[model samples]
Target: MRLLVTGGCGFIGTNFIYLMQERHPDWKIVNLDKLTYAGNRKNLLAIENNADANYSFIHGDICDKTLVTNIIEEYQIEAVVNFAAESHVDRSINDPAPFLTTNIQGAQNLMECARQAGLEKFVHVSTDEVYGTLAKNEPAFTEDNPLIPNSPYSASKAGADLMARAYFETYNFPISITRCSNNYGPYQFPEKLIPLMYTKAVAGEQLPIYGDGSNIRDWIYVDDHCTGVELTLLKGQPGRAYNFGGAAEKTNLELVRELLSILGKDESSITFVKDRPGHDQRYAMDFTVAQNELGFSPSVTFAEGIRKTIQWYQDNELWLEEVKSGSYRDFMAEWYGER
Candidate 1:
């Protein structure tokens, strides 16, 4: 497959690229990224340096129609797998405009360009956050659930998802959308919960827990999410949306305790912090559609995935340091300094 993967330098996108290179060595991949503060070029150093690499990296924005169109024509692209967006909830809360511009407008632009280019497939990577929070006893979210996004980040994604569906309906564009649960694994930016906690815990810094730490999420391994996306690109029907979940639900407190146990720490290491505005209470996804139709289900357990993720951070100390420096330092201070 000749593919154009936007946001290819980011967390999940990087993992997907690695998997594709390993399993489908002959496939050519063009990675287009805006190289935002969160987009670390170092994530794909190996692929860039490999003599036999079939990878091409372009530093640009997806909102640029000319650049995206040129890439499609130049690469003879057959498929588009969009993983690009301003994805941090805290960041989105601090500023929603960027999220709206990149997630909603950028997505629409990509789809329009792809439609005009007559691409064979467009796979939109989305999150379960679009379904909003669930009550403790409420059923997990399914593809049919009404979108009730509570945060700016999720609201933008929901808009993009609807746009993708509309494109398929109105233009007969071939598009598949995958809504996944929380993902934790290698190459993840440290600002997120798992890596942030892991980084702080290792440094003997206080691990911040928001709003009594009871918010629940279903955690899927990064590789598992990548696998589901691959399946969607390969087998999913147009105009259909698939939910990919790990079926592993853990509260924020429970997850922290587990990480503490793994790190030989105690509860004293954690500090309670005021929760962000409109924080969802819980999220769980029913990925039966992906399981039944695409033969996609998470293979990594929470315990195993957590261990692997922590180990990855521990093993790549230099990378951790590099990522933590520069703009990330300012971000950390600004976010945590208030707490």
Candidate 2:
């Protein structure tokens, strides 16, 4: 099974690539990553060093139509799984142009190329953020929920999701969309909540919390998300959308406290800060379709996943240092500078 996996260097994509390489020894995998601030080639050093490995990496953006088409044709890509995008909500709020370009335009380009190539399946990895916020008492988001994205990051994703749906409706394209919840696992860039808090708390630095720390999010381990995506590709119906979630819901404050507990740190490291505009109050997913059809369910509990994640960060301090230096410093300063 030859496949083109875009954004294979990012957090979730990195994990997905590792899972695929380890499980499908005979499958030829081609990874295309722009290697943006969040993407690190070092994440796949083990696989890259394996002489017998059937994985290749391409450093390029998904918006390049010529490059996308050439790689698909050259590799005889049987499937396309898109994981590339500017995903940080804060970054999107600061600048929305990159998000629109990469998330929407990139998706369109890849889908067009895939259609032309007649790929067997095209799985578009998405996020539950496209459903917007839910009230505290509201139920989790389902596959049939309306797209009411509240952030630039999510709006771009929603646009891409709609585009995928449109392709299926207009051209009978074999496309499946899977919207997953917040993912936390090894090699996750420190910009996100879990990694950011873990790094800060470990260094005795202040762990920033936004908007009274009441925002709730459903968390999923990266491996589980990858499995869900894989299952969706293998068994999911075309023109259908699925939701993958950990069923673990926690507020910002709660998650921070859990991290502090795991790290043996106290609340002294906590600091409340200003919330960004269009911040959603809550997000949860009801992945019944993925569960019933794809036989997908999260295996890692929140506590277990958090413990493993914290240890990964602790053991990979060198990686943290490298990624946190240079442009990452500038990004942090730009986002948290005023706070």
Q: Write the per-residue lDDT of candidate 2 for residues 206-297, one digit (tens) a residue.
A: 98999899999999989999999999888989999999999999999999998898788889989999987889999999988888898999
Q: What lDDT does candidate 2 reach at residue 334? A: 75
What's the lDDT for candidate 2?
Answer: 0.93
> What is the RMSD of candidate 1?
0.7
- In model 1, the Cα lDDT at residue 183 comes to 96
lDDT of 1 by residue, 1-339 (tens): 899999999999999999999999999999999988789888999999998999999999999999999999999999999999999999898889999999999999999999999998999999999999999999999999999999999999999999998999999999999999999999998999999999999999989999899999999999999999999999999999999999899999999999999999887988889998999999999988898999997899999999999999989999889888859789779988986
Model 2 superposed RMSD (Cα): 0.7
Compare the candidates by lDDT and give the number of the best one: 1
Model 2 / residue 174 / CA error / Å:
0.4
For each candidate, what TM-score against the reference? Answer: 0.99, 0.99
Predicted structure 1: clash tally: 0
Question: Cα deviation of 215 in candidate 1 (Å)?
Answer: 0.4
